[model samples]
Target: MSAASEAETRFEREDTRRRWLLSTPALLIILVAAVGPLLVVLLYSFLAPGSYGDVRWQFSSDAWFNVFLERDIFDDTLAPAWAHLSIFWRSMKLAFITTLLTLVFGFPTAYFIATRDERTREIWLFLITIPFWTNLLIRTFALQEVIRQEGLLNTLLLKLGLISQPIPMLFTDFAIGLGMTYVYLPLMVLPLYASMERIDFRIVEAGYDLYASRFGVLRRIIVPLVKPGIIAGSILVFIPSLGAYVTPRVLGGGKSMMLGNLIELQFGQGRNWPLGAALSIALMAIVMIALLFYVRNASRGGPTHG
Candidate 1:
């Protein structure tokens, strides 16, 4: 090789090494701070449960086996863990419903904010984020107050002569879904607003100019353009909704148990650390699958901005 070529290669290698050295602290933090707990949980999931609340040192896949199947203590017959499956299904169903609800509400809210003049837009965005100022638990309790049988909605309806009595709303799947949508709505709105803010409105105008109906313009010109945001918002809302504990706990009143509550039950009252760890891992796997789906869609969607 020529001297110049050799010199350039040597400089590039040094630069790469320097970059790695600079990034070492962040890499180490991620490995130790983040991966350390996960590694512990992974190790715990493979161990036998203690007689009481913790894990034993002995290796066993019984915890994993118990996740999907339960061996009958009497006949040694294996059966599907119907209870666990139900909890898993409920969690996924609630998460999916929450994502859909947030999208339905947030898309218009985002578009509204995006369409506003700059000063007014800032005010609306600020209002959307005001919920973040309160603690999640506090917000959940407020929602609980609103939806509980004797609460605001029923009271107002009763006063307005719209109801014969207080409607039962709390301690149900409906309450759980409502709480999750309320909690995660901002997450959905922000991403959508970001995407919509970058859109070229002239295309929308052109669609209308071409005699496209409002629905047609929205379907063809707007939604396709905000596909990436929609995907991102769904992921943000869905993954967290899957593991949501506080809202479901408060709203469902323990009757409508979710996967998060089930996991907590194993760890806390049930005294099965191995099972809890297994469940934690299962939840992470679901999250990873959602992330992968998002990546696939995002790559396909590409940039939608003008």
Candidate 2:
């Protein structure tokens, strides 16, 4: 309306345009690198496989159908792919267990760190993150050495006369679970601590002053306040655990297979690129569903933890 108001509006529009221009490079990179490849994969999922490493451009529903059952391409006879479905279910189960284990261990660790003085908290946080300094493969190998029958744990137990023979620890589901927890515990703790750190101590004190029990206060006030972090950390741990290859391979002795291993098999030995692409797309769909749920939950939770 006024000349000065019009000038302010123009300035704001110019600032917005400048911000978009500045972000264009990142947008272009995402389009070309990530989205472009994803589109190619999606296209491949709908097509048939070539004899070698290439894909046939002919449209087919075989890849999608193959996800849950095996079918003869010529005769059209279908059989249940119980093995494939079971692998997916097993991956989900393992991921859920890993998330629960991490939450159980990490909550107290995070709370302790959150309650500490600033310097002490920094030291504890640094200690938690020390594992990241080493290569993951090297760390996994170290774990393998420790858990192997003739390795450190068994040897120490033997010297102490705790057992006549080394206990079977490697190549079991338990070993894979342990590996997942060890790797992903930091991911859980960091988010929980971040959420816990922002909680108002005065509210906690008020709860105590009102004669609320510790558990009561924690459940009613603290837990609600930090629900976002719990969800965020769960997503971080669970999704990665579902797709875990190294832990299942090395620790589970390659006998216990998960979705990641299945996907790798399709691409590597099986040489079925279309099926691999379909599997990848399925994994992506699962992740997107989790994210959508997260977004809906965050919106309902409001600004405090959202």
Candidate 3:
């Protein structure tokens, strides 16, 4: 080989080495922090549960079987764990509701912000992020104050003669839904706004000039264009809502428990680490399945769309 060519090859190899060296710290951190813990959890899911907070090294399938099948001690026959299934279903249902509600509300807010003048947009964006300034627990408690029996909502209703008495709102499924929506609304809006802002106004104007109605224009043009943001926001809202702990604990009154509550109970009061790990894996599987669907849909829709 020519000396010049050899020098070029040496330079290319050095550049590759430099890139890998720069990325090594992040790779190691991920391996330690994320992969390490996940592996431990996976291993625990297959191990026997200990009397205390420990796990036995002996292999067991009890944790996985406990998800759907339960053996009755009295009859020595296997039966369905309907309670666990119900909890999982409830978690999924609540997450779907939260995602749907956020999408319905967030899109309009995002569109309004996207349509604003530059300085006005900045102000609106800043307002959206104000929720992040306060601690989430404090914000959740503030929501509790607003919706409690003697709180602002009831007080206003009483003064207006809208109700004969204070409504029970603090510890219900409705309150949990409301709190989740409030907390995650910003997550949905920002991505949507980003997508909407990138859209060319001329395309919208063109649609209008072609005699498309407002609703029609939005349905066909705007919605399709911003599909990426909708998916992104839905994911941002859905995954967290499914495993939410604090919001449900504060608002759901512990009576309306979701998967996160179940997991917490297993590790804390329930003292069942193996079951908890199995449930965690199950939750992750659900998320992965959803993500797979999203990826498949995105691929089929072509590169231009989400």
TM-score of candidate 3 against the unseen true structure: 0.94
Lowest-scoring 10 consecutive residues by lDDT in candidate 1?
297-306
203-268 in candidate 2: lDDT tens per residue? 999988888899988888878888888888998998898889988898999997899999999888
Backbone clashes (count) for model 3: 0
Name the TM-score of candidate 1.
0.93
* lDDT (tens digit, per residue) of candidate 1 on 1-306: 999999999999999999999999999999999899999999999999998888889999999999999989999999999999999998999899999999999999999999989999999999999999999999999999998889999999999999998989998878887888999999999999999999978899999999999999999889988988899999999999999999989988978788999999999999999999999999999999999988888887576352
Q: Write one digit per residue (lDDT tens) for candidate 3, span 1-306.
A: 999999999999999999999999999999999999999999999998889877999999999999778999998898899889999999999999999999999999999999999999999999999999999999999999999999999999999999999999999889998999999999999999989998887899999999999998998899988988888898889899899889999987888778999998888888889999999999999998888877776566632734
* Candidate 3: regions farther than 4 A off: 1-13, 302-306
Model 2: residue 1 alpha-carbon error in angstroms: 1.4
List all candidate RMSDs to the true structure: 2.2, 1.9, 2.0
lDDT of each: 0.93, 0.90, 0.92
**Backbone clashes in each candidate structure, one number apiece?**
0, 0, 0
Task: Specify the poorest-scoring 10-residue window by lDDT in model 2.
Answer: 297-306
**How does each model score on TM-score?**
0.93, 0.94, 0.94
| Error at 142, model 2, angstroms | 0.9
Report residue 219 deviation for candidate 2 (angstroms). 1.0
